[model samples]
Target: MSNSLFQPITLGHLTLKNRIVMPPMTRSRASQPGDVANELMATYYAQRAGAGLIVSEGTQISPLGKGYAWTPGIYTPAQIAGWRQVTDAVHREGGVMFVQLWHVGRVTNPDNTGGAQPISASAVKAENVKVFVDNGTDAPGFVDVVAPREMTKADIQQVIAEYRQSALNAIEAGFDGIELHAANGYLINQFIDSESNHRTDEYGGSLENRLRFLDEVVGALVNAIGAERVGVRLAPFTTLNGTVDADPQTTYTAAAALLNRHKIVYLHIAEVDWDDAPDTPMTFKQAIRAQFDGVLIYAGRYFTQQDQAAKAELAIASGLADMIGFGRPFVANPDLPVRLAQGFPVATHDPDTLFGGGEKGLTDYPVYQAAK
Candidate 1:
């Protein structure tokens, strides 16, 4: 059977050669002292340019937005110049790339932010959640998240301004588009989830109010970069990082309707992939599609060529999704699209060096070679 995974698709004004996408996965390899992208990061992305579209790892929009150590940021001029190297490398290989703007909200400890308190939609803490941080000691490791201060109206406005500025910075760095990191229980997700948000202001309480932050940020990004060049990611059913909503279907469906009004480029769904993780029902998928009429992307644990190819084909053929994003697969298989298409053997990646590391696991993954 001929699969539609290799077919071309048009997203806004950008035409993707295939449906395979390289979604963002934090490598935590940014340069120290400045937390800026570097030539090593550029080489890593260039090696995986075989994907139809590449979404860079979650990049903090400002110093205060950072949660994990060594992740890249977009606020400083040095950081902007560093990211330019990455964008240039991907473009030289004829690949379209988007930077995922991020703010970790309460998903951090004071150790990671130079003693600054983490802020979120409310003062509530994410129970049992741990964040990787450097305590100015020997090595960096995981630490339990602390309670965050409730964001004031002024704080809210400043974050929105930062998002707008980050969008402009992304353009300055020569990216094809921008993908807001509203998923994975991050800053935006904290506001959207009822369990994490307990405010009575205009930015919380009712469902519409909770979505206000997302709406404002998206509007700002769309205004700065145009709706056609912007995308938003959501994790409706994911409980990762202590995010929980009373009714995910209702909440996320309403979110889809709201985003439909903006007519953004696409909606990327980050499906839960952990072992024994609950499956995303078709009802939710249908509800979201009914409300938002745009390209849809789904990313999860699909790895094998046989399974992923079949899933991708079914998704596009049935109008359920227009693209499929492969995360961990791209970590080991830089030329994953070619390997999947040609039935080549894929390499395994080391989980130990998945986060902060040097060139060993970052750029040393070998491309597929035929057995002689």
Candidate 2:
């Protein structure tokens, strides 16, 4: 039987050895204050080099875009120098890593953003969602989430410039390519959500207007990094951040159709994960495929059932998604491909170290020696 998970995938000019992708996961362990990418980050990623592709954690473009002080960035000289070492290490271990560029939008608190007010699609504050303040424990100088400053026409254009510049920085820092983080409840998403965006400006109202910022930024990224090396991740209309959109299907379909037109290297959709989805999931597989000729990678929480994997393979084989991602299982079992191949029970991930932590759950997960 052909190992679908281990099969090769052609992502534009780049050829992945397997379909397994270590999608961008924020470790939140960068050295504090400056949030420099140290040797630890490099070693952590090198351990996962067996995957076909590895997308690094969300890296901020400029100082203002940083929501968490501990996360890494691609802007500063010291940061670039630090990340260069990480890229060099991953390359030495036979890995291809792309930096996921992000702008936090209104999620930022003024206290953490170097005194700058958090900016979003509108001046609306996020309710019910709890953002990580300073730290999880001890003193934890956290504050209630506040509404963000609505960006002016000039601010919107400047943000796009940041995306382009960030792509340039990623290439110079020795990354394989760039992934525009239009997912999560971040800045791009704020602009995409109808409830969050309530302006009569050019960037609000209709789906085309809402998609304008993302389109401009993505177009700028392609211009900087080339279409062959650029990719995008979208969350559609669903909200994991305690916020919901009025019409998700209309939102995601329009976004997917517009993105597919770019012919990017791939579109990593935040597809169905939860069974009790209050908002019905939109299957843009046909729509996206009709519009795009590149790859489609679907992710967001899945199990390793043989029947499930087989069904997924059939869908991929039948042209639904080119690649499927397994997050938690892979986090615990570094040899997830091998375990799945042998139909062995997958190891459980340590919930303790899933977020902020040391090497215990980060790189200490033992691989099946036989696979080695």
- Candidate achieving the largest lDDT: 1
Shift of residue 248 alpha carbon in model 2, Å: 2.2
Worst 10 residues of 2 by lDDT: 133-142
lDDT per model, in order?
Answer: 0.90, 0.77
Q: Against the true structure, candidate 1 has what lDDT? A: 0.90
Regions of candidate 2 where Cα sits further than 4 Å from its true position: 135-143, 278-283, 305-308, 370-372
Model 1 ranges with Cα > 4 A deviation: 135-139, 305-308
Query: What TM-score would you give candidate 1 relative to the actual structure?
Result: 0.97
- What is the per-residue lDDT of model 1 for residues 1-372, given as tens digits with 9 covering 90 to 100? 355788899999999999899999998889888889999999999999889899999999987798888889999999999999999999999899999999999998887788899999999999999988765642469899999999999999999999999999999999999999999899999999999999998988999999999999999999999999999999999988898999999999999998989999999999998868887999998888889998899998666555645666677788888899988889988999998888777777888878886888889999998889
Q: Write the per-residue lDDT of candidate 2 for residues 154-247, one digit (tens) a residue.
A: 9888989988988998898899899899887888988888888887988999888888988889889888888888989887645755345687
The residue pairs that clash in candidate 1, if any, are: none
Candidates in order: C-alpha RMSD to true structure = 1.3, 2.6
Model 2 residue 343 lDDT score:
70
